[model samples]
Target chain A: MPNIKELEDLTTQVRRDILRMVHKVNSGHPGGSLGCAEFFVSLYQEIMDRNEGFDMDGKGEDLFFLSNGHISPVYYSVLARSGYFSVDELNTFRLIDSRLQGHPTTHEGLPGIRIASGSLGQGMSVAIGAAQAKKLNNDDHLVYSLHGDGELQEGQNWEAIMYASAKKVDNLISAIDLNGQQIDGSTDDVLPMGSIKGKFEAFGWTVIDIEEGNNIEAVLKGMAEAKSLTGKGKPVCVLLHTIMGNGVDFMMHTHAWHGKAPNDEQLEIGLNQNAETLGDY
Target chain B: MKTYTYKEKKDTRSGFGAGLAELGRTNPNVVALCADLIGSLKMNQFIDENPERFFQIGIAEANMMGIAAGLTIGGKIPFTGTFANFSTGRVYDQIRQSIAYSGKNVKICASHAGLTLGEDGATHQILEDIGLMKMLPGMVVINPCDYNQTKAATIAIAEHDGPVYLRFGRPSVPIFTPADQKFEIGKAIQLTEGTDVTIVATGHLVWEALEASKALHEAGISAEVINIHTIKPLDDKAILDSVAKTGCIVTAEEHNHLGGLGESVARVLAQHRPTPQEFVATNDTFGESGTPAQLMDKYGLNSAAIEKAVKKVLKRK
Candidate 1:
């Protein structure tokens, strides 16, 4: 594995990739994607036990399901940077006949994506099922999932949350990007999800908190801690308190950039903020 | 015309369980999931036999659909069993995005479909599952005729690699199909031969169609009885061939006439060959709480209803 400095460089490139991909299409959710850059870098580069190439059946490797699929920019970046597919294909992010859809799907046979997820509130259940399958197969590898804080409002998350804990799905670790912002406004202003950590604990899960979700070291440590908490008769939940837009200066501190693409000048400014670390995808 | 008889009455759900248990013995990769309807879906034997392969997913049907889609990622053939109402309408989006669009090999085995859901009333009965499932691309919609055919279809679907909606009933209709018959996915079975009016039926209405054919024979009308088990990817050749000779058709199902088997048959006939058709289905209304027989009769889904429909179609011809 690469050192922390190398991982940080990968993170910088991922942010650039996210900015450019969305700018090219003039669509996609970049606020959450920028917020999740470090998390994706830490997960694919440091944490996960992956294979040399991607296969639909993630049999031996650690499986990850992106339930909050609007943030496909960062996912595609990390996947390409991690060798799941060619980095050049990231250019075709929402084009016609492009495998890279606005949301991640296996419909076009994208290698790393196990299930289709633009429809929120369904991924947690899918991750739970894959974790259960790992148990059934006697494979001890873990299953991980990431959901937006606003995506939890879909109500299917609660059904899966209740079920995962009740069934002791100890092989899974679910992380929510607690950015406290959504498409409309702040999550509190939108729907006011009362105490996400309290809710997870009440549903019988071991909860971990990362004060700064955008920090690479903090994300790496928090996820490692969550991994250690697994297999103890409860699924682990990581409440990652991240800023909606982490790296770029003008995009931070608001949910206004949640689904809006950066224009040419804004993209140039955003690209300048995060210099080409590992070269642009 | 050849006559048909049954020695016993059996619910189609039992055939599902029987087929599931057989798959448990024969195929190792087959797994089953249910959302708090094990007894009603008749999945006890498979659960009792392969406890590990069977999952009790509580009362969350949407989660059940999502989980079933996920299980297919690891080379597992997942069969989800639940009430038809919960299976289709309750989680249509989950089935649409996860299973259908993703093209997962999951079998959504729905029991207590249509008005024959009986006593559970309109809320529990699902008359639009065939329409809802068949509308999605690559989704195969199958409504087996009898208990024997249902069992065969349940087993055959695990081998086919895509999403399938297998709709069955709660009532113990006649076990008329062969016990050891090969279940074809999109083929229609010709139960009787005639040249007057073709009678195509599925699910609980199949037995009723046979009775209508017998009654039609007595009435001097040569009604051809064709059992259309698969609603989508329908046996258009069988329908067209029968209709070319008969010149008119009657479609019977325990569902609404709006989007049920009749409409699918109508689409095929309208595209390929124009034929006068009468629909033997509910007139787009919710079912009421009553016995299966009472509900079928009240909703006009009985043998008498099919016989009346055949006469109505004969006049159009």
Candidate 2:
């Protein structure tokens, strides 16, 4: 397990990467990516039992799929730092001929991505399917997935949630970045996903709550508990309560920053909050 | 002209089921997923025979599409079974991102396509599926004519890589195509040879085309009948060669005239070798609840309509 200081440093670096990548492209989702930085760092550094060299099927190692692919900054950062690719490639995000598209895709022959999931509500089902595949292959590795809170409004996510529980996809762990904010406004004001934990429990999932998803230690403990609940004949769902922009003070608790990149001055302020623990890409 | 015989009449969905069962026995990598439509899709035999390889995903077509895409990651060939309406339109984005765009080796098996879905009405019958699927890049669109052809196509798609849409129907139709005929992806089958007009058709319309050819032969028109099972990656050479001799074409299908097999053929002909063509298909109207025969007659997807279309195209030429 990584110490809190190391995980915190990793989170800072990921936040820096997210801001830098989104700023460079001038078009990408950065708020949710910044919020989910700690969770991703903890997963890669401690939680998941993944192989260093990537495999498409993830045969003998744990697998993760980003259902909320808009948070590609956090995903790509963690993936690169976890040794999937060089960290320098992070600069080419959303650029022409870059593997890191505006939305996460497997079409560019990225090693870590098994399925393309820029379109919302499809990732949970894909993750469930991957979990079922692991069972059929007799590989005991677990399948992990993450989705945004606003994405729950999509009918396909409900379909997937119903299926994962009904089909007893116990070898899976799904998380919701319950940031309560979308591109428009708060989730309550936009579509209102009321009682998300109760919703999953009602769908027959083993639900757990992480009160501070932005905190590395809390996120790690919540994920560990989620892993333990797996293999017990029920799918596990973690409702991660996180701030939209966790590191940068000025960007937090606002919907304006959900998709918009920071200006020159705001970028400098954001960079200062997240010091480059690992060298900046 | 050689006449065809139907020993038994069967639903094309049953052909898909039989093909899936056979595939299970032949290839260990082949897996099946049903969104609570195993019986409707005629996939019970495969499920019963290979219980471990089959998954009952309830009434979640979107989730089923995603799962089918994920199953391909481990090199497993997955066949997702659902109604034509749910298979293409309901879960289009899932199919687009996970299967087509991602380039997963998934066979989207859709049953009860077009007006043949019968009494369930316009809500159930899907006339735009062929167009929707064909529009996607790298997607193979297939609409087999009979039980034997559907079975052959099912087995053939498993061997080919990338995404494929295998469309079948619910009602029992004539089983005319030979069981021993080998199935090719983009090849059109020449059922009869003639000199005056070319009759091109797909799905349930192939039997109609055959009947139309017989009727035209009696009237001294000698119309050639071609079965175009594969709509996208169309058999241009066969169509152009036949049109070169015939000089006119009549396309028929159990779907809307717009974006159906007729339009696809017309596009090919217009680009390569332009020929006068007439379409015997449903107009831009929704299907109503009725018997399969009633719907076919109401939509003008019948032998008489095909025959009339052939004469009309020939007259224009």
Candidate 3:
């Protein structure tokens, strides 16, 4: 039910924002941000039934939490584009006195962020708690969260995962970014969690696998399917298979760009790849 | 000094349970989460009354802390129940990032704190929980004495709008405070007035402080007694005014000499009054297996210890 053309345009702008924001500071985790641009754009623009104005208590609306907070550039850009804050503030990403922290946090009173999450593996438990709250309120709304593939290594996620299914937290959707890369190396090199989909299935989540996570239509189709699977008896998990850096040529398929920013020449090349779709923030 | 008496004795954890049950009946927004040890936490009545509001997190303290933070997003005031050791040290990062730094209205109701949580020994008995909790900014740390006051503090924190670390213990100490007393955070209750050394105490030591005041009065010392329930956002006016009259202080608690209520009071006195003080607490050592009463006496956390501290600090005065 979305205009595919506009979603693509929004994704392009988000990619540009990710590059420019990180490039300005000569720092940030651009690999994950670029890879998650489409997911962020689709969630904010099409998927979530949200209010025009932001409230700390997101009561009556479908809530989305980015568990993999290093991808905050994409999250912030999409939030700005979707009218959470001024798009011009994207320039202050990771700067002093700015709400746009390198990782998403509510400590700065950022409107879109509900909790601080630079530290990995905490978002899942928080999301599950939100889902439980929705059930307590009889709100009939869904809670969605996105986590990095590498972040699954944290022991706390398993504790939360086991709890969600055991409690029948059926109104929640947790999507894992299956980019297979981390800061030090690929997930396999760091600490391999074999068969990520099978792992979630064993933990009792209804699994949805999207092979092309970077493609806007594929992600939309996958997410819609995920929303349909909710409210049954178990929490849902989406195995989003994506390249580390999808938009740019040099950064793709490598863990080297995990937390590094692009240089001036590399920035120009990245910008040339994604045209000015909705104008750079 | 004026004498006080209690008809019975009760654990502060039971007070928390009573307050939680009251909240369940009154405030529909209140929710309870426990990481195991529900019986130890004395949360059976609340869980039984409001099964939907109760969350059994099953030994995952970190996840419980995180979920408590998340529950605040949808306007549910979550109270996480666990032992003080696990509540403060084990899931510190989860609380730091999710609740404290984010400033969520989650009540971390920790039971079984300090040497009084005996039989389980040092692993379960956390002497430094007050210090660990009070160090976090925007975290309102409270260690109420007696069953009545803990219950009042529990009910009061639910009405407060920020993160609160509500600390209580397992042992059944004397319950002297009025059952219907209006509990105020950061406001010290003046138990007995005097002009000699100020005897400020918290947790299980408050009753000991009262007893010390009585003995000191009999010995003609005229000792002052104050109940410092809330450690952070401390009752500075009461402490400063009392110290202005008394000139020196003897701080006591069922905790360590470092980073506990004794140190918090010391910081305030050092900055303002510059009064000499003696601490009646565990001397930076771990507790061993013993009865609560035995441990209290061994670690200098009793009426006699408070009496000795009062006498020592009066010499400096």
Candidate 4:
């Protein structure tokens, strides 16, 4: 497992991967992917209790589900860097006949993905299901899931939210990427969801707020604390307040780069902000 | 000519419940989830016996679908029970992405299908479920004809390794098929054989086709009755072989004419045989509040309609 400094280097490299992969394709989301680099790095590097190889049925191990799958750039990067698949495979992101789809999917036999998720609000339900399965199997290892804050407007999330607590699915930790943006505009402008933490609390969830989501140390500490709350008869929810685009100066605090890729010049500037660390694919 | 008869009547949903209860006793990996339709889908026995294995999803059909897909991760074969409309149209994308495209081994058990979902009107009656399910890639679509066949299908799908849509209805129709009969997915059953016209049917309409065959026999006509249980991965060879001998065909179903079993048969005919055919289905219309018998007759999904279609197709031949 990587230390805080080493994890920071890996997080920088993931940002580079996101920018490069999306730039080569001239399409694919970059903003949310960039923002989630620290969380993904902290998760794969230090958080999850993973096994050696990949199988469809992830038994006796902690599993992760990405509810907001448009950020495949970050997911594919961390998955590759963590040795689920070849790091070189990141070059084929969203190309023809590639396992790296525009959204995260298990359809192409991707090693890290257990379910397909690009259609919003479905992941919470899937995560709850997996958590229930762990209970049925008597596997004590927990299930972790990440969702976009704006994706909560989809209504299915509330249904899953109500179900997880009602059924006492305590072996699960669901994290929300509070980047405050969507494809159209800021979530406030698009569709305001007032007091997300209050909403989860009212729905009977043990809410954990990570105020500095981009900060590596803060994320690791927050997630560890969230993990401690597991198996105590309530599903945990982490409100990670992250920037829309954390690494790049120009992309931050705006939703313009939510799904747009950087140009060749913008790519160089973005890459310069975070120097090559652990090498690129 | 061969004749068929039923001494008792039972709803196909009860067959699903019986099969689920049997699976609970036999297969440890089988789990049941219902969207507040436990009573309607007849899942009470399974829930009663295996309280831990059954998940009462409480009316959220979309969440039920996604959860069913997720349960497959740890090798749990989740069977989701709901109304046909909620099972298909209400959660099409969830099924498409989570179960179908992801290739999860989940059995989507749907009850109250087609116009036979009496008195609920068009809102609950799902006449287009077969079309919606069949269009998805790698989705096995099954519409069983009676109680015995439906029960057999419910148990059989758990053994099959892929996503399947098992469609049945609410009406307590005649129990004609054998109770111990082996339900083979994608295989059509030949109920009666003749040389003049082929009468193909599914779900509740299978009995109607058999009745039409008996009527046709009395009217100096020989109609071959074929029970098409599986809609997609259709038994094209059986249909082609029968049409080759009969020179015409009549497709009967409790679904709409568009994108239903009739259209699938027509596509096979157009590509292979191009035989003259008539459809005994709702003519691109919605069903209304009425008894199952009244709706079946009004929507042209009864034995008399099948008889009329056989006569019409024979004239074209």
Candidate 5:
């Protein structure tokens, strides 16, 4: 396994990929992508028990689904960096006919994506189903999924939440990026969901909170604990308290960059802040 | 005229249940999911036979669709059962993104389709399901005629590779088709031959079209009858060939005239043959509380309606 320094370097590199990809397209989302760099790096490079190659039916291997798929920039970077595809393919992000769509999808046969999810709140149900499939196949493997905290307002997530515990689906771990920011404004100002932790607990889930979601070590540890909590008669949820845009100083602490791409000057500043640890695509 | 008969009658939902039960014993990869309508969809037989393969996803149709799509990730063929309204309209976005767009192999078996759902009113009866499903790029829209055909179509779709929407009704229709007929997707069944006017019908209307043919024969009009089981990937050749012989056509279905099988046949004819066609379907309106037979007659979805349409089209020809 990679040490703390190597993992942090990978996260920084992934942040760079996220910024550069969005900058090139002038359309893709960058805020949520930057916020999820550390978690994606830690999960793919450290946490997940993945197989050597990719297949639609990921038998006998841990599966991951990206519920909040607007963060495709970070997902594509981490997938490419982890050898699912060439990192150079990140250059094709959001171009016509490219596998890397603005949102993640299996439509173009993108190697890592199992479902199309730009429409939020459907991922938890999908994760539960995959976990159930693992049980039916008698394959001792877990299924992991990622979602946005603001996305829980979609109503379908509650159905899945109420269901996962009722059915005792114990082989699934879902992480919500509690960035607290959405397109219009902060989640609090838009529509408060009272308490996410309380909500999951009330729904009978095993909830874990990562105080520093942007920190690679914290994300790794939180996810590890999440894995340990599986197979205990309830689904697992990790509330990751992350900044909307973590690496760049200007983009941080605001919802303006939720779907907007960085201009040339802003892109330069963002790139300079996160020095290229691994070479650029 | 070619005559048809049936010794017994059964609801098409029961056929779906019987087919699912048979699949449980044969196809180990086949799994079933229902959104709190086991009795309504007649899925108890399958659930009883393979309890492990059945997922009772209580009252949450959107989650059921998403779960069915996810179940396909591990190479499992998930057949989601629900009322037609909840199956298509309530979860269209879920089906479009997860199953149809992602190209997941899920069989969305919907029961109690069209006005024959009866007494539940417009809220439960979905007339726009075929149009909604066929609008998705890769979705296969199928509406079988009777119990035998519904069962065969259900089993046949398991061998198919992508998303499919199998539509059946709640009423007990006559079982005229053979017991061991080979079910073919996208292939239309030519029930009878004629030369004056062609009557093409689907779902509950196929049996009515055959009856219409008999009445038209008695009226000295040779009306050809065709059963269009699959609506999308429509059997254009069958419609075109029959229309080539017969000058005019009458399209019938248990759905609205706007986006039902009639509109599909009109598109094919407008492009290829430009034949004069009359639609025997409900106008853009909602159904009210009534018995199945009462609703059929009220909405003009019976054999008498088809006969009237055939006569009208014959006059135009």
Candidate 6:
């Protein structure tokens, strides 16, 4: 399931493994990990169902949650090119016994981290409590999340988007990365969330906007219409429209590469825009 | 000196809805979140006998502590409930990043907590939730102390394995400890054995350190209660072997002698047995609208302020 020119050569080798793992751990957060490299390479190469051996209680599949964890270099380069761990441990991202942590963590048990976020709006309440524990283990599966529209002015992500729309939770699917920039600048002059899709449709959610979030076929048609608007009870939210530093053209539109790093000649013009595909960690 | 008789008093949030409906009928991965304070955290009998492992979550205590830290990611065991000041200072960084730095077995529980939540003063009284859940890292704080040790520390923090907080209270006091004992989490519970001081205590001040150890065993000054009920890995070898055979210590708690359980048994008796303690608690202030017996006698936290802090730490030994 890989084409858009092999997902733009795996989003340019996940922005050259996020500028060589944040310039060899001189620190991390390369502008929301290169503006969330085509939404984590179109959700781990064409929208998640995932399970090539990465189970930390992912029971019967689909589960993702990186609540804007300072985008650990596009989530450790699409979890080491979608295999979950070693791509030379992405050269130890935030080093010193790194399970790639500068933010995402499960205290190093790290087989696709079940939890431990960079303390933002708590990853849509841990993906609506893992989609309410996959509907109490009957395992209908599906729970994904991501955030950082200036971490949605964090009031605990509006108390987890008003508790996944008053408990309907509908298996879950959340997203934001609206990249209006942050780390101290334009989130509308810092804090103006005015009309974040009218604040998640006034907190009952089901929103969806994706104006080509760096276009991996419009992020797989806005994540396949956010998974057919999840089970149809409620809880959806999309809004993508990224570019915090998308494929690094001079680290795209400001916020000074959100958490800097690109030194060696801006990581060779951010690895010549788009080519390395699946090799280069 | 036995005389302990209360037969009926209840409200340790209905012993956490009768220990979460007996851990949802013997743990089928025992769930239950809450937030909208389901009848003030009594959790309507485990949301009426497990309505598919109950999870109302309306008031959103920081997204019910991140969906009880993502329902411990598929292993379930959540718990949550609310109001010990919105379960520890309104979702303390969503329970310090989705349940204590992601150790996540969840269980926060909490009820009215200190100053007995009477008339909802000091904004639903919390008194520093066992020093903000025992300074986090790995967490397991517990508070219990009545309604048979908060229904045996809510069926022993559902066999423990990580982030717990438990706590309890909200008026109707006296139930007197043993309704079928066996709770344990971090041990402690000595109860009587005396030798001059060592009061110690915990939640609802362990019935004010068993009425200040029955008034220091009727003034002959024996006093040795103990009962910490787990305030984070702090059994410290039963508090340094009961302060090395009771040399001098007092404690008690309805919380707030800064990070309570009397500053974690005075920092484990000042880093191992340098004794002479005292505390009895609540002196750092902040509680109002009386009657949890006049705010446990205006915050001295009753049983004659743990029998005057066990005669002021046995007159500094």
Report chain B TM per candidate: 0.99, 0.99, 0.99, 0.99, 0.99, 0.36
lDDT by residue (tens digit), candidate 6, B1-317: 55466778778888888978998999999888886778887778777778988888777688878887888888988888877788888778878877788788888888888887877688778788889888988898878778878887898888888888888887787887778988888888887787777787887778767876886787788877888878887788877887788788887888889987778778877887788888888888889887788888877888898888778768778
lDDT per residue (tens digit) for residues A68-100 in model 4: 999999999999999999999999999999999
Q: Cα RMSDs of all predictions?
A: 1.1, 1.4, 1.0, 0.8, 0.8, 17.6
Tens digits of per-residue lDDT for model 2, B111-179? 999999999999999999999999999999999999999999999999999999999999999999988
In angstroms, how far off is B216's CA in candidate 3?
Answer: 1.2
Question: Which docking band does candidate 2 fall into?
Answer: medium
Off by over 4 Å in 2: none
Question: Individual DockQ of the candidates?
Answer: 0.79, 0.75, 0.86, 0.85, 0.84, 0.33
Q: How close to the true structure is residue B308 of candidate 1, measured as C-alpha lDDT?
A: 88
lDDT (tens digit, per residue) of candidate 1 on B1-317: 88899999999999998999999999989999999989999999998989999989998998999889888878899999999999999999999988998888999999999888788788998777888888999999999988899999999998898999999988888899999999999999999999899999998888889898898899898988998999988899999999999999999998888888999999999999999999999898888899988888888888999888888878887
Every candidate's lDDT: 0.91, 0.91, 0.92, 0.93, 0.93, 0.82
Error of 5 at A4 (Å): 1.1
Q: Write the per-residue lDDT of candidate 6 for residues A61-91, one digit (tens) a residue.
A: 8898988888877887788788887888888
Which 10-residue span in candidate 6 chain B carries the lowest summed lDDT?
Answer: B1-10
lDDT of 2 at B134: 96
Given the true complex, what DockQ would model 4 score? 0.85
State which docking tier applies to candidate 6.
acceptable
Give the clashing residue pairs of candidate 3, or none: none
Give the lowest summed-lDDT range of ten residues in model 5 chain A: A120-129
| Tens digit of per-residue lDDT, candidate 3, span A188-207 | 99998899888889989899
lDDT of 4 by residue, B1-317 (tens): 88988899999999999999999999999999999988999999999999999999998999999999889989899999999999999999899988898898999999999988889799999889999999999999999999999999999999999999999999898999998999899999999989999999999999988888898899999989999999988999999999989999999988988999999999999998889999988888888999988888787889998888887887898
Query: Which candidate wins on DockQ?
Result: 3
Poorest 10 consecutive residues by lDDT, candidate 3 chain B:
B308-317
Clashes of each: 0, 0, 0, 0, 0, 0
For residue A60, model 2's alpha carbon misses the true position, in angstroms, by 1.2
B1-317 in candidate 5: lDDT tens per residue?
78899999999998899889989999999999999999989999889889999999999999999899889888899999999999999999999998999999999999999999999998998888988998999999999999999999999999999999999989899999987988999999999999999999999999999998888898898988999999999999999999999989999999989888999999999999999999999999888888989999999999999998887887787
Error of 6 at A118 (Å): 5.5
Error (Å) of candidate 2 at residue B107 is 1.1
